[model samples]
Target: MPQSETLRAQAAPPRLRWWTELPLILLVYACYSAGRLLARDDVTTAVDHGLAILRIEKSLHLNAEHPLNRLFTQEAWLGVPADFWYASLHYLITPALLVWLFRSRAVRYRAARTWLMTSTFLGLIGFTLLPTCPPRLLDAGHGFVDTMAQYSAYGWWGGEASAPRGMGNLTNQYAAMPSLHVGWALWCGVMLWRFGGTRLAKTAGVVYPLVTTIVVMGTANHYFLDAAAGAAVMGVGLLLTPLMLRAADRVRGSFALRSGRSPEASPVRSPQVSKGPRASIVSGGCQTSAGERFPRQRESALPTGAGPDASPADTGDGAPAAAR
Candidate 1:
């Protein structure tokens, strides 16, 4: 039968093609959102992700007075409008990326979403647990001052605690431990490098990662350590990605197995019946296979030497009777 007719023979079919991972994605999203909300509830909040970083930072004496720290800790000499660049970037870039992905392939879209969200979620958890304030939030004269908050020009939203939390706030604020800004930007670069447009895409693939790392550290959104942690998270996330999809596939296959069903066992072939010569008995030996078998003696019209007990006539008579 034709393939078209064979497809029609199915009693039921999958409603969505390769949608097995959707449920798991949704579940992860729910847990992540809940964790973000818990930051407000100090008692239940898991703020270690960020606190852990702060503890290490203090141990290494890399606070405000540290030379590398002071570079980023210093007020933005480029002017306060830089916050406009930073704040606007966080708001606009990811969503725009996601939108572009919606028009692209589903695997890439999902992968991008996973990388972005996972990085953000881990950052948020750090924020709640660690809560190391940004340089701008520092009150001491030596520590970094909250330039965006202090400079009202384009940093209107900087340090504005009153902004209502929404579904968009799936990440934490004070968890600058592992800056998702840097991590997610790197994720974008990786996605583009792995699956982007053209020559320019390839160039961006090379440049974006380095540029993003510099921006985050120079701007004080992340420290060198923070950027390193972000990259680590991305690496781990990408490595575990195959496990997620494979797990979903196995679940479906398990269900099929339970019902004594599987990819139709390649139709069993019937054993072919041979139509060759039949076996025959020979002097002192027998044949039971395909090829003809002969005894260890030569054939002759007359016996080469008749036994003492039997004459040539007797042997001839015996051969004629056997032939019969």
Candidate 2:
């Protein structure tokens, strides 16, 4: 194989674990759907807990003035407009990649999409369970904007800020405990590491999370803890992705074994038969090994008037028709 093709085969992601993901994704969505509707007690407490953390940070000298406070305070890029990247562009990418995978060789995209989807599902759980309000919502007591609520056209409000169009357009307006932004960036980094051969490309891929972390904090959009949680979630997703791929490979192997026997593993099965030096010949057709002449070849250009048991004129003693 060519060098690039060889490298691609080596770097390709694992096979699809369709059976596992189909049900697992359904279960996850179901649980979250329940949380969205049924867990009012847990939901209320999570929001309270998030508020308590903000208070604790204030008393322990970790308040808005602390360098870590940048996660909830600074707005250095205030001069920029709010329309540059207000929408959740990343969300759009996941669905598009999913459709692309469905139409093409599914192996690579399956693992990646599962990881992204599962992680996003988990993030929704965190949102309802911890209901974090970003720093932009801080007001003056160390003010913070609900980054999830604010939709900046282009400005970087810092803690992975975005300009959401409206609350109705988003899934959860408060799911900021773990920034899926950072998680997807980590995912992209791994993908680049696995498939990108150039050192510079890999370097760029790896450095993005660090920059993203800064952008998120500087804009008061996420607390340091939120970004940490996002990274933790991606780590779990990465580990889960490979386990699924291996299981699918095992299933595919079993299926291929049952399809058809290998060519070399069985005797050829032709039906024509005869006796004598030119016994395998036919009058105007191809003969099978058991003397049953297959009639299809009667019209093809034959050398001359040959018949059943007629040996090739070129051979004095035809040797089993030279093994077609």
Candidate 3:
């Protein structure tokens, strides 16, 4: 078989253990969160950045959040549900979809996971570079309501970005440019639409991200442009997935080589007896019935008392000689 095919045939399938993935995912998220914290600017800086973005939106005539925010806040019933969806779905749905993919769609799970992770990392970089505030955190003069704070008495989340009371400091409120909420929601939708077993599943995937985008905007947690940037990041990540997988494979192969591990054990050495009237060639040394032992041959070596050009098995005796 060809060497590449041999290596591929011997390669093991990817492992999808929850116990391993859970910790790794948590660690990556923790690092992302911690990095956001370190990158956070003062409230004034964040708010100023947000205002600048809002101005740009106005210039582009794309400030959809104005009407959406007003409409959602005017109706208490609508606002409450939007708040819940914004806070809960991003955390709940994405992970559930990922777990489902890992368990049921093992073949596709790696690409999906890599895409999600890459997009998340890109979002983190955006957070570090442009620490813009979400609409909810802006000054009250801007007319943006803190919907979660308004419904704080109903849910476990405190007023600050759906985090638990007093623990809100652990979260970076300024990481708002490339909202992971919309990014992850869109990722879940894409994966489901692409891999779902049924039409309903695919339709749900399409509807879920759309709903998530509306919820984020209506709840004042993210601006319309933030959602766009989030989807853009996801698109970039998807585009880079093939390259990332190839790089990962190369790194794995290099590591295996450095560790002196072969993909499979060496082929077993067996004795080969010539069917023609010549001596047999045993890969490893073997003994004859006459109690004589023969060692393995070096290509340059000649038999004892034989000329340099003598045939290896030209002895007059009929008995075949062992590989010397």
Candidate 4:
């Protein structure tokens, strides 16, 4: 194989274990949550950014959020379900797809997981740089309703974002520029469409992300621009995943070197031999018993009175005599 092909084969997905994967996933999620909390900006600035986005959307004739938000707000059936979808699916479906990939399509799991994590961190950077508020967080004068708050009585979430009732403060409500709900949904959709192996999965792949984009907007949790940004973030993450995997491999190689082992080392093997008895060649057309130095000259062939110390001439076999 070519060197590139050899490296590719060597870098194939390794066997996964729940014990290790669970901790890694939890760590990334913890970082994601903590990052949101740490990247929070003041309300005034976030609201200004939100207003700016709305103005831009209006200018571009892409203010789809208004109609959808109004519909979702006026119809309780739509609003309540939209709220549930916005709050629950964002947390549930991403992890469920991850578990599914790990179990059934492990070959693609690592890249998909890496892409998600990379995009999440990138979203964190956006949250820090531009902490834009969601449409629902804007003043009522702006004509958007907080569906989660409106439908709070029906579910475990509170008015503040998607956290359970009293735990609302635990989440950051201003990180709305790049909607990871949409980004993660896109990731899940791609995974299902590419590796799902069934028509139902492929159909769900197309529908899930499309519905999530609408759900986020309809519930007033994200703007059209925010959904677009989320997808852009995922695209950037996909581009960076190969570099990330290569960097990880280098780190692993360095660790192996530090531990005095080569990552590419092959096992040592012994030479094979048959189990049958063996013989040693003494001379042309002659063999000797195992461990014997040479074929002994027959008594009749031996010169008369010649002893064991006789030279090759006396033996007449032309074999060299034993060393003195």
Candidate 5:
């Protein structure tokens, strides 16, 4: 290959197309959703677990969802908007932020995506293990009214919390302990705050997660502890990210090495025998059959009369040069 072409290839590593990771991302989410459904225990068992959580909340005076639920249901306008926000933002905002990061912040996008996916799977584990219920689905005497159902006239949700009209059956209603709505919102908030260029953008980041927390509570879809657990799961994901990446890199390196290839290795040149052991000076560099590349120094650094015939090791003192 031409020397110029080789140099350009070596200058920078190739970047993967942004869309390449999309399939993997989608597959992980699909698995998480399916896993949550399969993770479901008996309804009776789940209800008992839900009651246990509510009882614990009462003991600690954290059973604030009752008042929030009443306020939302008492005001139709407020309840409708809250339902919309709860249903739409959880799905829309998170994906929009992900697309934005992929398109605009390529460098940080991988870490962010990994962290988000990891946290989601972690939440799935919680759903699988606990199968706790949302506040709205609790018994009627608990005063935790299903605001989504009450405001179903204002929106399309059925009795389920923010679920679609007839599609409530498809959702994992018991996966309510670790609120991914709050978790994903918090993740978006953190990314925007850290990477956003403007003050207004940063402020929006802070407001979004807080508003989401209130929405989840007011909608009676999650307890305060659920939101906290979501944030905690995300924190664990962040901490595990570096270790995960490092382990992944090591496995990749091992595969490449075992296959007798280095991803970053330079192009191999077939050696060409030259008469009388010659060297070539290329643009911006030197090339030798011995496989050495010396970067070109300033033109003035060479002796005043040096030319194509100049000795490889010729100093101004003019001694016999060493053979490279």
Candidate 6:
């Protein structure tokens, strides 16, 4: 193969294995959670950032959080379901879609997985750089209600965040500059639309992200600008995916080299011919000629003083005796 073809083959997406993929997904999630925790800045700073975003949105007339939040809060029917969607679907749907792609559409799984993970890490970076508080976490005067808190009795989450009743402290509420919920929903949407091959899946691809955007806003978990930034992050990640896959291939290749093997190396060795002479015996007591040619057999010198008609000693069954 040409050098370019060899590199392309090496860089192709590897076969999926649940044993390896599960651990990797868990590790990335853990890192994302830890990053959110570590990026928790002081409440005063976070509030200031939130207010600045609010001012910018107001200037641009994009302050959709307040009205949607009011609508969710005023109606129990909408509030409860939106709260559940915000807390549960973000965790459930993304992984379910990933498994779907891994099992049913494996050819596209690696690139899709890489895109999601890259966007998630980029969101983490945004959190670390700008720890803006969610609209619900703002002062009561801001007119934003935390639907999750209001509908706490209807679900398993507590007032602090989407985490379970007592585990809210484990999560960072201030890391809301870029909403991963929206980004992940967009990822799932794209995956479903591109590879689903069904009418229902395609419809879901359109509805899931659109509804997720509304849910995040209505629940006051993210600002309009934060959702926009989430989308931008996904865009950047998509653009970087090819480079990321290439880098991963390089790393894997380096490890293979360290382990004393090349991925393209063949395991079978070539056949070798022996230089020593080989012995042959004629069947039915037939005697061999002095200078007969045999395939791949080197001629041997006859014993000293042996006549041309001399025959080698034979064992039973017409076998030739071993040379002394």
- Write candidate 1's Cα lDDT for 207-264 as tens digits: 7677666555555555667777778877776776666545645776678789887733
Candidate 1 matches the true fold with a TM-score of 0.56
Clashes of each: 11, 35, 0, 0, 0, 0
Write down the lDDT of every candidate, Cα atoms only: 0.53, 0.53, 0.78, 0.82, 0.77, 0.83
Candidate 6 worst ten-residue window by lDDT: 270-279
The residue pairs that clash in candidate 6, if any, are none
**Candidate 6 stretches greater than 4 Å from native:** 1-12, 264-324
154-216: candidate 3 lDDT, tens digit per residue = 777898887778888888888888878889989988888998879998999899999989988
Which residue pairs does candidate 3 place in steric collision?
A: none
The residue ranges of model 2 lying beyond 4 angstroms of the native Cα positions read 1-46, 55-89, 92-107, 145-171, 246-324
* True lDDT of residue 196, candidate 4: 87
TM-score-wise, the better of 2 and 3 is: 3
Our model 3 lands, by Cα RMSD against the true structure, at 7.4
lDDT of 4 by residue, 197-242 (tens): 9999999999999999999999999999999999999999999999
lDDT of 5 at 145: 76
List model 6 lDDT by residue over 210-286, tens digit each.
99999999999999999999889999999999999989878877888899966443233322323333223343223
Tens-place lDDT digits, model 2, residues 1-324 = 333443444323333465765676567656654544333334455556557767776676654323533333244243132123223434453344455554563646677766766676676667666676555554456544443334343343322335323433224435667876677667766665655568985895687667666555544556667788899988877777677666666665566567753212223334333333333345433443432333332322233455454434324332233334
Q: Which candidate model has the greater lDDT, 2 or 4?
A: 4
Q: Write the per-residue lDDT of candidate 5 for residues 24-142, one digit (tens) a residue.
A: 77898798778768645557777887788777888988866777888898987788898899989888988898899989998788788889988899998898888877878777887
